[model samples]
Target: MAFDSLGRFGVWRSYTGFTPEEAREYEQLGYGTLWLGGSPPADLPVVESLLAATETITVATSIVNIWAAPAKEVAESFHRIEAGFPGRFLLGVGAGHPEHTGEYRKPYDALVEYLDELDAAGVPTQRRAVAALGPRVLKLAAERSAGALPYYVPSAHTAQARATIGPNALLATENKVVLTDDTSEAHSIADGTVGFYLGLTNYVSNLRRFGFTDADLSMPPSDRLFDAVVAHGTPEQVVARLTEHLDAGADHVGLQVLGDDYLAALRTLAPLLAARS
Candidate 1:
């Protein structure tokens, strides 16, 4: 509920990517929150583990897919963690891609139902956020939950999202960044990273809404699209790209470092980001 606890920036990683020790070190690095992506299981022991390992840093699920993680069960886990860790955990939920979820139909409706179930199960709306992309869901998130957590998007979309959600709701945008100066290497890594999301229809549809052309959405996305979505180059350059989202009305920006050595990138950026704060 205390959104300010999740400072201006956070780190986004796969649910299984961090060990308890690594989480503690990340906390030490001064980022305010650790967002676990990859739609973690209903009983979130990993979240608990990280919460236990760190003292004050917030731990949030980038999202727990509604189709895969049942509302009632996740609510139980929320209570368990809330009881032990108190105000250090935030629940982020979403309807996953249709390609993966066989039961993914009428996503907006299903998401409303899931939120209703969570409401009945005693999960406070202020403590949760919805993964929203389009206008309808963005409005729903602002009205029904704490805010929206939009993934795989640019500052242009962030600006649009801010207008839709209004000024008060938390707009935590996930940005995929490669901390390298080589243009070729950055796109090479981005191709492998951003390319997968391009396959998902929802993401493509969302991009179209933001004026991305068919050519930009092709198998190998246009350079314009790549440059717009993923931030690369020196830490200063990446920070500038992230700052654009902040200027566009993002309350929080979670960096999903794209490369094999994630901690190294985080280490490299930590001091610079802390200085900005």
Candidate 2:
């Protein structure tokens, strides 16, 4: 798989966040992929809308949660999209959060079963990525899918994931970034953005990899944790923070704009972010 097909930076936003035209403009701005952030259902056709709006940007599901979207249905959806769009869609699948999953048994085993289902249904290994954070899942991703898609992690975790997954697989890390010069507003916005994730054990557990202790995991989080996970500052500063992932061996960085006026933020940010790539 050509991990570079996703380019250096992808906009990680929900399909509901932008209009079809805005999705097209993202392509014009040189982003190689549109990371549709929500765990979309099996019959998601928003991918086609984005592809039709643009000639070249890849549209990847930041993940299609395995719990809700059955593997057979998702594989059929992937097949349908692949038929129309060719190599444009990359499927990202994950075992979702334990907090949200009621019947969440052994997550690792569930993920393996899901992957086996995808494989049996004719989904090629190179066409999908696994949303992995821990060592076992990271290694499983390298062996079973295109690569790893890690969300809410700092560059330190990216480096660790890359080493664990080895050199060949894709490392697409999602970083929540706020492009604002107002320090107070940025922190406020970042705090709101991270507050919900702080309550999720999976997210907080994954964050601990970046040297975050229980104290740092408290509500509002520590400044060290905030600065590491949420990149907020002027455009150049944000770009530098995103670059840390690349330098740490990320194949692609999916930037999820953590503020209102996402299109404006992406328009303001895409060029600056693209300039670095």
Candidate 3:
């Protein structure tokens, strides 16, 4: 159940902006995988279009939330896509955020129950992954699935995750990249992005664990904190920052550009990443 040929680093694209043509273009650009974000409902046709358009690239959900997509429906979609695409589809599921899910309870328990249902429905553990952050969920991800896909975390968390989950489980981390030389402007855009996650307890707690105080995690996000979370500056600098996660033990890294024009950013950074690879 290994991923077909998705390289060590992949692009995190918004599902809303993705088209069949764009999906094929990404495959042509040497992007091994495309992580679709913004919880898409279990629509096998849409998923099939994405898979059908690309020959070699893997299309994964940054996560399909348990609350929004039921295990049975997800299993149906998994089977539909895998039947056609085989190893090209990777199921990334999670217990989303409490704010998003109106009736949030013990997420760990809910996630376990969901996985149990997925298991019962015949979705292989090796074909799936979990969106995990803390120790407990990360441990569960390792035991129950192929690995964990952690978001909004720094390289230090990757090191901690690798140690906690051990060597075999896939440790993939998402890093936000803004290729702008203007520090002030970059922080402004980065701050707006960081502000949204600031309210999420999981992100806040993880930042604290990485040595950021409440002050550092404030709404505006102190410069030090911004620098830690968002990789800014030239393409070379962004590449250097992203490499930290790979060096820290991440098996793969997902890059999310801050602006709307990702093609330009991809063009700028692809060469740098190629050199690093």
Taking the tens digit of each residue's C-alpha lDDT, what string does model 3 give over 1-277?
6743558778886767678887887777667778888887876336678888878888888888898888999998898888888988888999999887898999999999999999999999988899999999999999999999999998889999999999999887899888898998798667888888998887898889999998888878888888887899988889999999989998888888887667788777877787776
Q: What's each prediction's clash count? A: 0, 0, 0
RMSD of 1: 0.9
* Cα lDDT of model 1 by residue, 5-66, tens digit: 99888999999997899889988998889999998999986988898899999999989999
The alpha-carbon lDDT assigned to residue 105 of candidate 1 equals 90
Pitting candidate 1 against candidate 2, the one with the higher TM-score is 1
Computed on alpha carbons, the lDDT of every model, listed in order, comes to 0.91, 0.88, 0.86
What TM-score would you give candidate 2 relative to the actual structure? Answer: 0.97
The all-Cα superposition gives candidate 3 an RMSD in Å to the true structure of 1.3
Q: List ranges where model 3 is wrong by over 4 Å.
A: none
Better of 1 and 2 by lDDT: 1
Best by TM-score: 1
* Minimal lDDT window, size 10, model 2: 15-24
Q: Tens digit of lDDT per residue, candidate 2, span 1-277? A: 4777899998898866756888878888888999987789988758888888889889999889989999999999999999989998999999989899888888899999999999999999999999999999999999999999999898999999999999998899999988888878888888877777898888888887667898888886788888888888888888899999999999999988887766677788887877788
| Candidate that would win on lDDT | 1
